[model samples]
Target: MTAIAEHKPAPPKPGTGGGDGGFIDLVLRFRELTILAALIVLVAVTTAVNPRFLSAQGVEDIFLNASILVLLAVGQTLVVVTRNIDLSVGSTVGLVAFVVGDFVTNSDHGLVVAVALGVGIGAVCGLVNGLLVSFCGVPALVVTLGTLYVIQGLNHYIAHGEQISAAEVPQSILDLGNGAILGVPYLPLISVVVMLLVGYYLRAYSSGREFYAIGSSPEAARLAGVPIRRRVLTAYLASGVLAGLAGTLWLARFGTVIADPAKGWELKVVAAVVVGGVAIVGGVGTVYGAALGALLITTIGSVLVVLKINSFWQEAIVGLLLLLAISADRLVALRLARVLRKRNARHG
Candidate 1:
């Protein structure tokens, strides 16, 4: 009886994800669960300290602030998952923001044209980064870093020590950024739509899955005839376009285009993606997770303020959280390995 009991199959791990179990597994994954729990705890503590933190205005502020970062983080997820990075996104946004503002200032190119211009400019930047990395065989880090400076330099030169003030911006554009539908802010709504579209493609399409394949094992991806070069290029282009859109929104939301608005934003976006549970190593994370990561990062800043923590401690706290997230991932991985080994040993 004891032997039979010992031989009985153990129930599957809660989120091991087999067949009908996939969605459950996704929710229970250590990384996703950690971020969600941390966010909840942080929110609760902040609300306790100041009930105003959960007020409608406060909630709107958190989501609005998170919108651009969430957009950028989602795009960055695709690139990082494939073992690449785009440091140029910050510069891309700055340049496009100023340029779009400048364009609309004199010509009145209309909102659609202005947005197209920004996205096109960004796509061009992404294309350059992609070409150098994919065809020229340059390291992605080096390429994007160089592009970052090059773009920022261009933006500075174009601005010529001038700024695009709110007076110069079109009201319609600002309305798009500031307006709400059914009491929901447009910025967050825009972010949600982009997130859903990208996430769906990544989850439902073969080409999107190819990105995961490339990140997992480039050599294997090559063997499997994955179009590595094209995919990398597309990834960068998507990132650039999103950054550009963010820049356009930046202009709309702030109505003051400085050459340095998003100067150091790339690091924050990367932090969100990492904290969201997307493996920095490549090929293991969801855009939804990245979005949550953005929300969590944004909320932390607000919570710190609500709790009256020193402003200086904000970045430090973010850094600590990132470290904790990575460590948790490693611990979970190690635990899984041990479990597998023990089970194999018993079977043997």
Candidate 2:
């Protein structure tokens, strides 16, 4: 008679260092490498179709366009790493953009004050989300969704059918948005700096790795003495602050704002994060990968324009890419499950 083995899978450890950690490191690098390869192929194909697509301005445009999404994706990565989501970020961005733009225009505030206001407002929004989702024990999805509607309503009431225009915005703020330094645009530069900082933190800091542990297995993480609630709250707070910063930059970039600015952007940001190799189910991904994903999405839009393809197809392509990414994640999960089962059987 053959004896059946009971299965038991070990939970991932925060800041783990061993064969397992090395394997995870390899997976992370591989995911980012695949994205870079795809991006290169995309750029090459589009440039082949239209030489002008590879022009200096065209490249800069792609990065500038991706800057906002990259920032949002970085913040989203932090939240998602902890098995949480912030649906309110889109609305938060819209509110900050309009409120900061209006306040700056009326008060003639300097760039520093405008930025401070945007960050502060975003922090308030994030704090509300963190408090509710963390201490109140509400589901993150439901909490963020509710906040989304509430924030959107508040923005509409404040705007009152009015919009901020370039004429009303200060030159210093506009310059920060549109101006380039040493042949590089400020928008993309800012995004790159944020991405690097986040990527380093996630890889180098114990608390940051705890995020992955929490997402991988919250019960296990708690058993390991990790402070799950505090980390989750911090994630939402970071997401909000980044969204707010993005809003202020949005005003500068466009020199215009409406109540509905950035409406329905949450989906795009999620798509970018997921496509960047972050599992929707959580426990894996990097800001570097997420930023590359943003760049890829932006490149796709530019590719359509340079190819003179129908604009409608852009959404279709994005949807298809999202499906593919999700499928890829599912496959990875299956493989991981299989590996765990094998390891369990060996012990059994």
Candidate 3:
């Protein structure tokens, strides 16, 4: 009898199927689910304590307050996912806010034009940081840290201790902040659209996958034919654009802008992103989670006020939540790593 040649089965991809892959997927999916559950619980508890918390007006207030931070957190999530950080966003927002205020007060610019200009300026600042980091081979952290000072200084010089009050802002612009659509605040609605766009891009696009790949393993992504430099630059540019957009929202919401607009906001933004489940080391996270995080933190602050807790507890509570988030991240990471190792061993 003639012997027939037998075909061998193809090996599974490193991050695919039947072994550690399933476990990893389960863990990641669960992490996101858990975060959602936590948010729901928090909302329920707060509403229970103060029934007014569930009222339409109260809900709108919470969302509106979280809107700017949500924007910042989303941008921060992208940067952090690429294993980089943008420390200048707070300052960038401040600079853009001040610039918009100046245009409105000192010039004859319309509200729409001023908003566009502010966002445009923010994009430019982000572009500068991206170029320095991507082309100059500088660390993102360092580049952004420097830009923070530069942007802040520029804001101060431009404002020259000047402040723009509500009177200076056009009624139309201020209205943008308070206006609602189908019972939803305009700011939050805009924020939701932004988050949805970003979520779809990251989850459904090839370029978005490349971002996760680069974050997962930069050298490997390069080896796999990913355009490392181009993607990194684009990531930073997107971040800047988002930051600028956030500044416009900030200007509208506050109806005033000063040299110190959004001062110390970067930390809060980062914290929100991290606590929302974005990995600090990169290659993992969802915008939905980050948005949830922003909501959670915002709610916490509101809850404190409603509960008549001292304001000092706000920082302390945030610190505690941050610590818990980091700890949880580490535990999840370790578990995933262990599962991977075991599967590799079994398959080999």
Candidate 4:
């Protein structure tokens, strides 16, 4: 009988580059590139359908419309990066927006104070969610879902069916949303600034890395002495503060606040983050991607208008885009898994 060679693993590849590793690194690190390509495609298509879609005013409209979602998505990205979710953002924004409106209309609070109060309230809500998730060891989904209803109910009770109209809002506060700097809307500018800071922190800071580490492998991060609990709590708190800021912007832009100002917004924010290439499971996304995702979602609505399609199709299109994005993510995961297995066998 012929002697059979033992089942030995192959030798490691020579170069540190090439094959699946490089591809995955490119996908993970340059997710923004994909988003940019998608955005370009969207713009091109829209412009083809309606040249007016590329007008300066049209561009401004898109950016302004996308700004709030961008802000919300950035916060969602942070929490999701840590393998957590915050379903309460919509309710948080609603509550805070109404609070700001109420303060501005019913009290002697200045614009600055009103803005601060809204953000503070949001931060406090976030802290509660964070504490429950971190200290109580509750899953983020369950915790946030519970808070979502609780916060919404609280908002309804506080508003007591009251609504603040544009006539009642201060000019200064409205300017926060309407004002433009260097020809760009202030809200979009603020979103850009926030994105820059968040992107830098995630890319360069140790604490920020802890989020990725935790998401990548919680057990490993814990063993490596990462303060998982504290960081996670901070993530949720940051999300809340951002949501509050978004609420204030909503108050300014809409010039009115009701208990349901941002109903169902949390889902949209999550969809934007996920569509932008952020991993739903966590630890693999960027602020840039989240911002791009927001832009893309906003563009979709504009595109629909340009195409003169029914407004009803907007939600359906968004759902379709979300499904495609999730499918793409699943494919990427499968390819990465295959690559890892092959590499392990080679090294074994």
State each model's CA lDDT, in order.
0.83, 0.86, 0.80, 0.84
Number of clashing residue pairs, candidate 1: 0
The regions of model 2 sitting more than 4 angstroms off are: 1-24
Alpha-carbon error at 120 in model 3, in Å? 1.1
The window of 10 residues in a row where model 2 has the poorest summed lDDT is 1-10
C-alpha RMSD (angstroms) for model 1: 7.2
Considering summed lDDT, which 10 consecutive residues are worst modelled in model 3? 8-17
Each candidate's clash count: 0, 0, 0, 0
lDDT of each residue in 209-301, candidate 3, tens digit only:
677777777776665666878878888888888888888878889986778688888888888888887777777777788888888889888
Model 3 residue pairs with clashes:
none
**What are the clashing pairs of model 2?**
none
Off by over 4 Å in 3: 1-21
lDDT of 2 by residue, 218-258 (tens): 87677667788898999999999999999999988998999
RMSD of each: 7.2, 5.0, 5.3, 7.1
lDDT of 4 by residue, 278-320 (tens): 8787667777888898898889888888898998887887788
Ranking by lDDT: 2, 4, 1, 3
Supply candidate 2's per-residue lDDT for 273.
91
Please write out the lDDT profile of model 1 over residues 197-284, one tens digit for every residue.
9988887787887787777668766766678899999999899899889988888888887776898888888889988877676766
